[model samples]
Target: MRLSTYEIILPLVGTDEKPIEGYTLLTNGLYGAVDVVPKEDADKLQAGDFAGLPAALRERLMLRGHITRKDEAGELADLKLLSRIFKTIQGRSGVGLVIMPTYDCNFRCPYCFEQHRLKKGQDWLDNTMSDEMIETVFDALKDYRARGYMVNGCSFYGGEPFLAKNLGVVKKIADKCREMDLSMGAITNGYDLETYLDFIEEYKLRSLQVTVDGTAELNDRRRLHKDGLPTYDRILRNVELALQRGVRVNLRVNVGKENLHGMKDLIDDLKARGFIAKEEERAKEEEELRKTDPQAKTKRGQFSYYFKATTDDAHPEKNISEQDTIDEMMKIGFTAEEAVARQSQYNMIWNRMKNLFKKEGYPDFSPAYCGAEMGMLVVDPFGKVFSCWDVVGKDDQATGYIQPGMSRFLWNFNKAKWRTRTVDLIPACQSCPYAFICRGGCASRSSNAYDDYFREFCGEIREIFAFTASRLAGQEWEKRRAAAAAGEASMDACAGELTLSLAGPASRFTEAERAKIMETNSQKEMFDIVKGAAFFPEPE
Candidate 1:
């Protein structure tokens, strides 16, 4: 047997009262299993002294993928095969279409990435999708559905989708979605959300993602109107109105050095408005309902918020690194875990790994970072279709075009280029330990950084993964310790259930083999007796 290449080992720093000394936390990046073992056992495994370990320990290690059969092909090969299967499944699952009604905006945020497209006298500003175009878009969706691509939903995107002038187009699109039995959502500035609340409620809008840079003072200075008027109060009021009308609001706080200090005040303001309390209550109610009905759907309109690091190439000095933002978040009364959760991208990877450790199933592996490489297609006002939202307005970056008579989008080589950009194709990502998790990073960012779509634009991914693994390991160690204390037979506090499936011909193990391994020993029970005793000592 040989140790997996993706093993991450760290020293366990227990509490002052009960120091978990001489133990190491180990995790496999690919398998997403976490365990605590004695330092000597880890050393023995590293030294390739498998015979020196107990038979039960060896069996457990193999089961968790910490150690694999020497004849096995390897984890990297398995990951590549799994990723391809995942991509194939994603392509058929559904297509998430982004509709840009108009490129015109009511706000002129200094750090807006779409500023170039919103310039004065630009044709993009005057280009709004006509009612005919809206009808054509829905027709294209129906065509895609007929072609075997499920129509997942439609999301409104633009310089600002909720601009007062674009209300007619927005309503038309929402009405079509309602007619098609499709869910509708939007990414808007929220200043004009109140005007659309009636439509939002009527169409059963699933969600709205709105950005609020900071508290009123900080936000007003940042997300200002085109004429330099304050937008904070009006936006907040409209957000509250949307919530009252049963529209889920995802409040995004753009954090930078300039407004990082105001996050606490912003969160405090949200709490004062009862937004946080409402979300907490909704969460509790949903948890209770799910206890009775595992598949029960929860009501919409719960207000939740996350912090995102601002990106401003024009004002590089004002932007804060993600780590710095997390640290600042910690200073503002967030735990390390909570602060990490604020970064959506990192949090997504962290959550996937966390879920993998808790459940008995393979990670939802993907070769691409997001839907750009999957089935996501963004259509702008002028019939330009893009694979990535960041390149929506750039003609050269457009993947295709759509017109009134076209039954389907007229895709070009650019679409294939985007669809084929996966971790396997990226040379750097192939051998990288976090290849499956990072998936070659964002395609647009990669192109912007290396001037090539296929190159690696690994931005803080290693650091993020390290932090995530450490946090996950620490949490798992604590769970096992608690389980031992409570005299539980398993470390998994929840019911143990695992799902196994075959990927393709190249897959290492069959479904039956996977099931057999799972039945050998419960993951928790494998570590239940480490070196002839429970992992944790009994209380006095």
Candidate 2:
């Protein structure tokens, strides 16, 4: 038997007051199991040198998948299985329609990538999506529904989706989604949200991802209006109103050198304004709301914040290293663990895996990382369709387009390329231990910035994973010890069920289709990293 590729091993150290020996922490990234084993046994198991270990110990490892009899060919087979499962899921999943109604945003944030284009005298206002294009989007959605796919939801995107000029277009799309019983979400600047309360309630807008940057005073310096007016207070008020009406508000802060430290202040402001509530407090409030008014939408769906490190390849002067940005969060107030977790997407996944958080069930295992694949398409203002929001404005990135009188959408290889981007297909990721979780990292971002699908801004993904696993392992160990002291039989017995399941109709794949996917072809060779066409020209 051999260890799984997803295993992460770390030295099991004792408390700071004392020292312990002959133990190591073995964690399985896939199965989410952490165990402390004798150093000698660990060494033997790792080296496939199981000579002196007891049968019980060996059986336990094998059952947990810490040790498996699988050979290299078996490992490859597992990956193929996973890839097929992903493809099956992708085939049946709901189609995400991201509509960019306009390219003109009111915000004049200095760090915005689009601002560089604005300075170059680009007439983005004139490029707004025509009414005919909006009609085309509805036609496309109908086509998807006719093809046996659910029109899952609509996401309103663009320069600033909430801009006054775009309100009519927003209302049109929102009304259509409501008519079809689909949820609606938006990525807006949040300045004019007060004007959309009717649309929000009538259309059942579920979520709004708005940028706050930092606290009121600090954020106002960057997230300003086109006329240089401060927008912090207006945004805060609007977000608060949305929360009161049962909308989930996600405050996306662009963490950089300037606003990194200010994040703490912003978080504190949110706490004071009732945007964040402690677990017990939130539970009490929710119970009270249920008792008083059973039909009320929410009592705890206020808002939460996420941090993204600022990057502007079109203007390198605005970029900051991920390490530096994360360090600033730690220097200000967050612990190293919190800093790392909050700075990344799906931060709750770490806690869920470690058995600390349980609000949502364990994450469902799916190969699709983002909307770029699985037909989550973006229809730009000009009727150009791209695979993801990140590639909207670039003409070269558009997978297809709709002409004024065309009865159907055009097709391209870009959409097909993204459709096949599974973890096993990435050259740099194929042999990497964290391939499943990383999932080849934002394809458009990697391709745009580094001209390679697997490359990231920092290549420190492994380090981040290692740090996260170690911290979670330590937390789990302490919890188990506490349970033992309290006379519990074992922590595992009370830890509740954890499930890992594949997505969609894998059982229904025809043998012919399976054989075609299983064949070794040019698609396999496409994994090799290579720079091809530059979608955008260099700035003068």
Candidate 3:
């Protein structure tokens, strides 16, 4: 009879047996022990029941399961530990994916990379994706079951994706997604707006970053048809109709010196419509609420906060501070009283936001991620899978295209390719300092604007980041203001309230003392000081 010896590890969650430094534990403090058993009886005295032990030893035997498939209990525990560890490290959550259905565009905008398609002329058309070709795309997505990703379905695009005259195409895709109940939608520049009305309302198109080159005269000049005809008026009409029907519309402007003038006009047009819709919706909601709860009176500027990036890099109250917003409000409203009133409301909104930020987590914060890393396989209108939307029609170096049926190409990158892509990846496109949450900016736009994929629109992004962060900070400030807004209170009451909110009451402990206390009491501090530390945070 053969004899086998095995040592089992027991995890000690609540013990002094902490891990050593640098080498973090895959499993926690496991007590040590070994057992000798006959091969024929190996299964009987394994894990839960081990052979030959005193009652005290039996209670604390620390049976670390075998690291093999023969120990089914050990194997199951290993898998569970693996799953837990994976979740902790990878987050393993699905992110939103945007599939550009087509790069074929109607308008030949001077700024658009899509115009490059027009410049390349028939080459893009020859390569354009047909409706039938899309089936292969869908099937390829199905083949990726082994990888843990869910395709949110395709976001149709094009030389105006509508140019396909594929109304049935959307319905067919929508029908399949409806059966599967997937998030499917499309982006269009509104050439065939009326036809796609039903699809927009029904599908609830998640995103619509439609390109608006400039104003009526400027836009018409920029976004021209195949024969170089103006399209601003037609597109605007379509946008208006879509908005009226409650289609989600994000008025996008590619800001350059030429079109900066048109942006304000575009905003004015959209805002008037938006405010009118807001008023109607507000009234409807109020009526319904009155019928139901009746006690929700939203103060002015409650929907959105108003604030500007300040000199201190903090979002503060606007009283006597934000002159730019005041000036802009006048232009947006086109009346002095209207401007002043709106500015006041905006200031109040900002105040409320600042107050909220003091105690709450980041609110309405959308991370600015480099869309490339998130597994968005954007197949241009011709069914060419390009990574960068703006890189479409260019050479494979600039454009992110791959052959059909080759591979769905999961975003999990190789080191050589990652380095190469990173070299191609503009430093500006590097992981944002805030990308532990906010992703970096778009690689394609950076490449197109600067001709360096690694270089970024840093100034634009910094301003946006500051602006976004300030708004978040402003929310916290608002909460502080409200807490302080309590009219008449005793000195003790005020002191107590303030002390409760602040990290360490000024009256109780000094900063050094508090810091020591935090370091000592914090769980992270408790475990980190131990022998081994295995994990590191994901790259920022």
Candidate 4:
């Protein structure tokens, strides 16, 4: 038997505030199984000397697939098989349709990533989607349904899809969506949302992602209009109107070094406007409601917000690191947990892995990072189709296009290239322990960084994973410690029970074969170690 190549070992702390002598928290990133084990046994297995460990411990490890038979099909092959299975399942699920009416925007944000497309002047900006093109897009959706793929929903996107000029186009799309029985949503700046309120109410608009970077003063300094006008009051008022009309609002804060410290002021403004409530206020209200109504439940708010670090490759100096943003959030009265949850894209992978561990003790296998590779079709104003939203206006990046007369999509080689950019195809990710979890990171970012889509764009993933695992291990250790202190079961008993529940069947290798395998490779190569380190500041 041999140790799995996908295991991460972290030192476990004891109840007495000291590092446990020889115990370590071992987590298999591929399987998402976590356990506490003796460091000596782990070392033995790492050295291909599994027979030196106790039989019970060895059996438990084998059951969890942490230790496998030497002759068994390798983990890389298993990963590839899982990738193929996931891709097949996703293909049969549905397709996401993104409609970009125009690439023109009233506001000129300093850190906008679409500046490359926006700088093409009025002639290019005036190329809005015509009524005929809208019909063709729906026709394409019809073709997708005919191919047995469900039309999931339509999301409005663009330089700004909710601009006053696009209201007619927006209504046409909404009318079509209603006829087709598909839901509608949008990612807008919220400046002209008032103009679309009638449309929103008529169609039961599912959701709107609107950005409110900071307080009025700070936000206007960042997200300003082309005519150099302040946009905070107008956007906030429209957002409130949308929420009142029963549409869910996701208020996004594009955090940068300049506005990172202004989040507290923005939160205060939200609370003042009754858009958000303090934890204590919410608790008191819930308690009062329960007294009056036996079946009373806390009201679910129509609006929510999250902080996302700005991505501006042109001006790297203007960007704020995620850790710094989270630190500032904690300083502004957010708990460690709250801060972690509110930070949007930074901890997405870590959050997914953590939630899966809680729900299933293992993560669902993922072949690709996002819907772009699976079934997302982003159609720009000119009917240019792109797999990823990041490369929407770039002609070379477009995977296909929808002609006025063609009912079916005219796909090119780029679509196949995107569809096949799975974790298995990336050389560096093929044998990496965190391949399934990270899924080779963002495809657009990878292409930009390495100038090749196939190259891996790691982007601080190792540090993020190590930090998250360390925090989880610390929490688990404390939970066990607390349970023992209350005259409950001992730590060893708790660990054994957890192992049995997580581990499945016995090893495929027999005793004789296992012993021979162990003795053959006395100096086996160790898996890459990710040290348990803190990337974010610890809460006081």
Q: Write the per-residue lDDT of candidate 3 for residues 366-388, one digit (tens) a residue.
A: 22233454344555544455554
Each model's lDDT comes to 0.74, 0.65, 0.42, 0.74
Estimate the TM-score of every prediction: 0.85, 0.80, 0.55, 0.82
Clashes of 4: 0
**After superposing candidate 4, which stretches have Cα over 4 Å from the reference?**
11-23, 38-49, 70-73, 278-301, 358-362, 473-493, 496-540
What is candidate 3's local distance difference test score? 0.42
lDDT for residue 80 in candidate 1, whole number 0-100:
59
Clashing pairs in 4: none
Candidate 2, residues 425-522, lDDT tens digits: the string is: 66655555555566667776677677965453224566556556555555555555677678875766333122222111222344554455565343
Candidate 2 structure lDDT: 0.65
Candidate 1 local Cα displacement, residue 117, angstroms: 0.7
lDDT of 3 at 186: 60
